[model samples]
Target: MSGVGGDDEHIWRLAVQKDGKIVAAGHVATAAGGEDFAVARYLPDGRLDRSFNSSGSLPGTVVTDIEGGRDQLRDITLGTRGRIVAAGSATLPAVRGGTSFTVARYLRDGSLDPSFGSGEPRPGVVVTPMAANDDLDLAESVVIDRHDRILAGGSADADGRFDLALARYRPDGSLDRRFGDAGKVLANVGPGSTDEDLAGLALQPDGRILAGGSTAATEFAVDGDFLLARFRDDGTLDRGFGRGGFVITRTAPGEADDEIFDIALQMPNRLVAAGECDQPATGRDVCLARYLVSP
Candidate 1:
């Protein structure tokens, strides 16, 4: 609500700078068309950093693909040398029907990094993985790997059902095909009959990847359990953890729908995740789960 916009706006994610400054990222609604990635920086005392983007905030877009459709920033992270990396989804304006996972990087001065994702062909160099088949793709969280690579986590529509999607890119914004299948991995947590999403991601000290979200068992049903998965550095599922590298916790099982909105490491090989749970009898409640990180 701090933002001045008559239309609906949102601050999806934020990150802290090493200098104690704050960088906030989200989307801003435009009068001419769709939303654009809106980013701003603030000093420790809460004063807007006038030096950022040469203003309180970048007046125009910092990153986008679709000129007439929506773009939303789901998460941001502090990268090497204090650079800023952002992840979200951009609607495909040229394609009449879908969205794509979008990412962008900015220098310390808040200027777009030229070496980052600049698209020319289908996922040629952009943070997005090229879509061989049409599907709505979205990036909900992002983290920097030990090698300074970029890893994105979210959901993708596969045959109309949402599946956990993760993409890894080099520091220069090029997809790392050596990772997942062609630089991306779509994990089916449900039976391909329900929805699933990766809401958060954490890169382990050993280069393993941990992702957490939610998934439902019933087809098309919203009620589900908190889902967690681990991946090796090479993007293959880790069979040692959970059941075939997956964990599902049902707080209310068939009685309510649960979800994980964020996750963090608790140190010493422990992880904690938190979100909201809804039920017919008891409105909404804060949900939390912690696990020993063996991956």
Candidate 2:
């Protein structure tokens, strides 16, 4: 599907339906402009979904935005009722804003859902910039809880500093006030002179939440480390896990940068964290680490 509209495509994350169907998501070029989130559904036989958004979506039903700026979908998962939920950042073209953490929901039929967002930027999109006036709010991961609540985590910038941010939303697409102050919590995971960027998130069987990513300084600095933390269901840090609810480990002692881009639960209390690390011999090596659940 390459065309003059800059058909460059990069798929970041995807989900498989219970029926064996697959849905791939990422950002697609915009002719001579920026990129908008591109989502494609495929049949089990590896055929494109010809019945999805046939004529209403655009560019072969690959677009999901309303009618403004460019957006990106970094992580995605299947929600209840077979809804497709994606998360990333958006450059609000309507307000000419820089970028804000965004979450969008789509029906199983590949059309935008009308229950998300507050009707500002659109109807099916959820735009949460942390402050709406902040510099940037970007989401790196998204997941659905046992109760079907939507949870997204990343970094939120304020005072020129970045902090770990996690927000919980009800199935109806409304903020769950019972959560961290209206369904949002921001934690300063970097104690030193650095910022923490949450890249991965996992839900424990006990309803607790686990997050993994990187913590380091910006501005051409190369001394970053991997960060992992555990949180209770109420959004509070799990003090029993690590030193003050978080742990920072480095894959490379004093080399470039290291981070846990993704994490998964092995059983009850065990977790597997995987990402790229700077290796002294091979330059970049695939790093994997295992952690006890109680730790």
Candidate 3:
């Protein structure tokens, strides 16, 4: 389940089964340079799985942060052979504005797998870029397909507003060019001033793609609405999604604001979104609901 604390110090991440059962949960409670550090384990029933971590904490490792301290885990994907991979950002000192795509892998026992990239030395172990760019780029969502292909959705800053970014990687951590340009692609949904984001993503049973985020209404302000886009396997928007490939949602009446923090696709083509909505003087409430793909 996707959970965020009101304190703003932590965005709890939990892995749950298809049947509404939570398998693991974790969060980063400190601002250790804003790095993504969290711990989690399987749940036997509704409690923590003692087999992984009795105390419920796992300290991740990093080989290099060419970008310094802005590392964070925005999403996680189960890896082949029973492993977990989290994707987010790594802050590279101010010299570069602390922005870099970052990923980390952990073994089934919740231990940092020394066999992955920059991991422990093994025979013929190779590593490559999952998805990287010069300017500000981040991985906000990730998942492993039935074939074990690593799919990710995120945002990349452009001249001003941000654009949707998608990429796929081989199980070995190498970029898959068959998906997009050098294994990466970008999309601009609306004519916004200085803001855009790819917040959550999910893969359909047939291999189609669904992406969600928001587009700024203005350049100097946060007057924007949430956006959801569906894409074909070729990196093109699926026109049948919302309207010409996308849909936008916002808080009714506009007394406050609404933002979609996460999204999940249910059976057929229905979608579920979870987020927080500011109810003016009432403060913010945890908002959760589902949407249908209108014809």
Candidate 4:
């Protein structure tokens, strides 16, 4: 509804609680010219929920500075016991314009859960550096599993190229080594030089993970294709799915960009993806695609 900080605020994701309360999260511009993760809870009627963050300067709002730099929440999900988990990217000021996958967990009262992340970076915040060379990595989507484990999907720099990246964290916020290579997995949907990013993530009924986004042929390609990748519970590619666990679809015939910003699982054997596809004649148009879950 209204601005939370009076300054510039951008809401990129929203989640509704089982009790009908709505949670909005994004980034708020700080007076210092930096940004901080901002979250606010509102009742179904659009009124601020005073019950949240009541002790803060702004009722029903919580602002977190993960690394004292730029922080934003691109996706929000409800966790076990009504906890809120948000995922996005945080700038690492020490890395010279580098960013990393950032996640923060909050209790029902909008208080940071100190029991979550290791205090190396910040309390109640988990900062994951996808590359050792300090590259830009971001988590655009987040989902919590039945076991309360957290899964974040986005893009990670792979040797100066962007690839679809996924990371799983245990309930305690520690990297789940049982997942990919130390709780992280990166998939190259196109050529090694292509940039692939995952903006949507969904868990199938059987716990399989599905991520969808876009892949650009070049670093500055004006046109791109929709990209989807499936992974087993253990984080390995689902070979039984699309070609080698990846599917690339060009929504339009020629030079047009088709990006999937979100995905949903539709029962027995289908998944639906929605985003925008650029049309040469007419600006960008809404696009939707359905895929069979099987090979």
- Which window of ten consecutive residues has the lowest lDDT sum in model 2? 57-66
Clashing pairs in 1: none
Residue by residue across 194-214, what tens digits does model 2's lDDT show?
677789999988899999887
TM-score of each: 0.90, 0.90, 0.73, 0.95
Among these predictions, the greatest lDDT belongs to: 4
Error of 2 at 121 (Å): 4.2
In model 4, which regions exceed 4 Å deviation? 95-97, 118-121
Model 3 per-residue lDDT tens digits across residues 1-295: 1222112334446665443434332333333443343445545465544555332332222222223354556677666666767677655544443365555666665556664544313311222222234467777887777778777778777765577888776666667778778777888776444466777888787777878776655531255566778888777788887778878777534635566778888875688877766666676677776778533
What number of clashing residue pairs does each candidate have, in the order they appear? 0, 2, 6, 0
Query: Arrange candidates by TM-score, highest first: which order?
Result: 4, 2, 1, 3
Error of 2 at 274 (Å): 0.5
Stretch of 10 with least lDDT, candidate 1: 56-65
The collision pairs in model 4 are none
Pull out the clashing pairs in model 3: 67-91, 67-92, 68-92, 70-91, 92-98, 114-120
RMSD of 1: 3.0
Best by TM-score: 4
Per-residue lDDT value at 99 in model 3? 66
After superposition, candidate 1 runs with Cα above 4 Å error: 1-6, 55-66, 94-97, 118-132, 219-221
